[model samples]
Every structure is written in structure tokens, then in C-alpha cells.
Target: MPESLKKEIGQFNVFYIDYDNHDKGYCQSYRRRGFYKISLLEGETKLFYADKTMTFKRYALLFSNPNIPYSWELTGNNHTSFFCVFTEEFIRQFGMIKTYAVFKPGSYPLFELSEEQFRAFKDIFLAMQREIASDFLYKYDVLRTKVLDLIHAALRLQPVGKLPNKEANSALRITSLFTELLERQFPIESTLQQMELRRPAEFANHLSIHVNHLNHSLKEVTGRTTSQLIADRIIREARSLLQHTEWNIAEVAWCLGFEEASNFITFFKGREKLSPKSYRNSKIE
Candidate 1:
């Protein structure tokens, strides 16, 4: 067992991996208790992740945030890798880990690296090895910054998408991220998990931008205000739930964050021109 894996329970842990130790390495993924992991592998493997499945060869970067379940199945002979696991509390300065495209579900978190890029990343991991092993003061602080560098650099490498309008401008980019965050929350997989960030301000808070700024960016890029966008999504989700699931109207309302079933009914009627029950009944009929 690696020392870092057994090290004193704390907010931060870092180490290069030994592939044979499957329990302690990045080779397996599941819903972690609280920590987030970032890893780089040097060989081929099949990735089974919550949002998608993929296979990678040569060099790959893998990111695992809490609640985003993932696992790895080795396919090639070599499985050398380095990874670090740390809690959100470990780096007080950094938040919005979710906003990073790499950590978001349904986005490609694993990237095959070119030889040159692979060496560059390997260098970063090597530095992490040296830093964590050293007795230097403020080593954790230094390590945190290095990890941030690794994360942001990887994010910059993600191929640009059309929706974010990277070609348009900064505001448009922010708007795109906001839209994606909203979309990722649903089709509401089960009635058990309640929806969050159902309001514009919640999203603005998550994006670390002012609500007005978020609304302005969204309005400019989408021609719809932030509230409008959120409402549209909620209505879309509500419609899907009503039309498909056998859950009662109250249950559907609860999943979408409505406090009372009547409130859900009024909201649905105003938007869809039919009550939730009526809509569901229509679908059934």
C-alpha cells in the first residue's frame, strides 16, 4: 500500500501510483466520499464513467470529482501513472471545480496527449513527487498551485465547442458555460434527487459572476434572459417528467424543487397552458 494512500487522514494527499495496487490507485473509480482526484496514465485503458464510456491509448488525463462515478479497465501492458486526491477544503482559494469542462459529466474528461504534451505533464507530476517528498515549508501551498496549473492548462487544451461560442467573445463564453451547467442538471434521472440551482442567482453564484452580469451575457448571446433560460429548462424537464414517469404531480413537483404541488400546478399552467395533471393525462390518453 502506498504511504499517501494510508497517510494521515487529511484534506490533501499526493503521490505517484503503482499500478499493481488497484485499490489505492486511479485505475478504479466509484462515488468517492468527498475527495476529488486528478490523474495521468501512460498506457491504454477503457474508461467506464457515469456520463460516458471511452477508451484511451498511450497517454491520458483523467479527472474524478465527487459524485461523478468512474472506473478504469487496463487493456495494455503498461499502466504507470501519477495522481493526487484532495478535498475541496484543501484549497480554500479554488472553487467552481464543476465549471471546469474536464470535471463536468458528459464532457470528455480524458484526453490522449501528444508525446510532447505528455512529457510536459509528466514533468509536472515529477515536480509534485519532489515537492510532496520534501520537508520544505508551505509545500502544500506550492503543491496546490501546481495542481491548479495542471487543471487550467488541461482545460485550455479541450477542443473548443460551438455552443460556447469561443469565437464570439468572453461574455458569450460565460453564457455558454452557464447554459451547459443548467443542462447537465437534468432530464431528472430519478425523483429521489432534487434539482438544485433552479434560479439565475444560484447559477451566477456558481459561476462567480454577478447575477446582472450573468443575465447580460446570456441575454446578449442567447436573446433570452437568464431567468427565461432557467424557466424554459424547468418547463422542459417538467414536461418530460409528466409525460413519462408514473410519479404523481406532487412527486414531479418536488423533484423540480417546487415546495407545494399547487405552486407547481400554477407554474405549469402558466407556461404550458395546461395543468400538470392535464398534461400528463393527455400524454397517457
Candidate 2:
């Protein structure tokens, strides 16, 4: 993360993509960015999300949260679009953004937009850009509404279903807390910034609950065990460090809570089918 960006976690920025001014560096790698992003893409593109590949030949709206690791490639000539990136603090007053399905963990955040819908969304983004640049007072208030507009617009596209029951909603809330806690420890920027919560019991203890209770809550909502979720997130961070940083395997292991490089290698290989060094080399090639 850039130093300037690190200081502006509460700020937001909007942009209109001029192909001439577009930079591929922004979409170059699958890593957890320090902020959230919502983009309206108007060209052919391939999105490589963790364990999933989605190719969009036309228009698509992509919602990226700080927790997920992702990257994209432009496959077509036309690269015009609109996008806005903001940190959680930028919209913290609205509510927990992760509670929404599009930003929720394990949910696919991409939405296909029709031409008409695209036009409408374009208007929203343009409005946001305009408002953000204006000298008017309470412009941020207006921007917040526009952000919610974009989210609600995508929600409308999703198939309607029966509302989640009370019990399920309770489970969902616990899942959201677990997801937030897990995400808070990420984007690990340095070797000295070792992870403090690497075990399920530690997380549960921190939350003042039993380990089995935490596992039950996660399983109820995500259908995955607590250990599985923790391991998956560790793998994600390990991959990011391997590809995006110059850290050696041992450094990566230490940052991720593995005391020894061999143990880290074994853990990574068991999940990824490739050693950390091999994965990094593959990305380089």
C-alpha cells in the first residue's frame, strides 16, 4: 500500500476510465488490497478470484472487498468504465457493508448488467464523480447516497428469495463478525507484523466463546469449519506474500505464524499443490 493511501483510510475516490489514461498496474495481481472497490467494467475482461475464474465479454459490475484476493485482465480493446475505491471508514456510518451479499464472504461479487442498467449505473458513478469534485457542502452525504444506490441497484438484479429466518440471521451475524476479525489481521505489510490470531481457539477465546461454538456458527452460515476458514485465509496471505513481496519463505512463514519454513512449506503444499517458491516462480514466468 502507498503511504498516502495508508493515511487516508477514511477517504473515497471515484474515477472514469479513459483508455488512454488507464493503467494495468492496478489490476496486475491477486492480492488483498487495503480498501474496498466497486467497478463498472465495459469491456472484455477475465477476473481471477480465489479458486474461481470469471470471464466477462461485455459489461459487468464488480464489487471487491478488502478481505478477498483478486485480479483481472482486459481481453478486449474497449476499456472504458467507471470505478470508485473507498475504505471501510468512508462508509462506516451507513452500516456494516459486509452484511450485504455482494460483499459478503464466499459470495460472488460480480454482477452482469444490461445496457439499460449499465446506463443507469454510469449515471450514478458520474454523479458521484461530479459531487465529489464539487465545492458544495454536505457533498459527502450525497456521495453516501450514491454509494448505496449502486449497491441497491445490484441487489435488485439478484433473484428474490424468501427472507432468512431469525435463526439464520443470527448465524449470519456471527459469521460476519468472524469474517471481520479474520480480515482485520490481513494485508500483512511486514515480517515483524506477525499474526496474533492463527488458531480457532484463540479466535473463540478472544470472542469470549468456546471453540466449538465458533465452529458451529461458521458452519451454520458458511458450511465450512473454523479451521478450514483460517487455513484458507492463511493460504491466501501466503500466496500474496510469495507473489507480491520479496520476502523469503521463512519470513513469510514467520509472518503467518509458522515457526519453521519446512512446516510452512508443508502446509502450503498440502493446500496449493505447489511449494511457495514454485508458486512465486510460476507467477514470475
Q: Which candidate is the best by lDDT?
A: 2
Instruction: Please identify model 1 stretches exceeding 4 Å from their true place.
Output: 1-9, 20-27, 159-285
Q: What's the true lDDT of residue 74 in model 1?
A: 78
lDDT per residue, candidate 1, 90-201, as tens digits? 6646655556777653455677788888898888888988987887656777888888888987986753222333333556457667867886787587879788888888
Per-residue lDDT tens digits for candidate 2, residues 116-218, read 8889999999999889878666777788789899998898885213223566555555677788888789779988999999999989888888888888878
Q: For each candidate in the order shown, give its overall lDDT on alpha carbons.
A: 0.74, 0.78
TM-scores, each model vs. reference = 0.51, 0.57
Number of the predicted model whose TM-score against the real structure is largest: 2
Off by more than 4 A, model 2: 1-10, 20-26, 29-33, 159-177, 181-200, 204-285
For residue 188, model 1's alpha carbon misses the true position, in angstroms, by: 26
Q: Could you tell me the lDDT of residue 176 within candidate 1?
A: 60
- Listed per candidate, the RMSD to the true structure in angstroms reads 13.8, 10.3
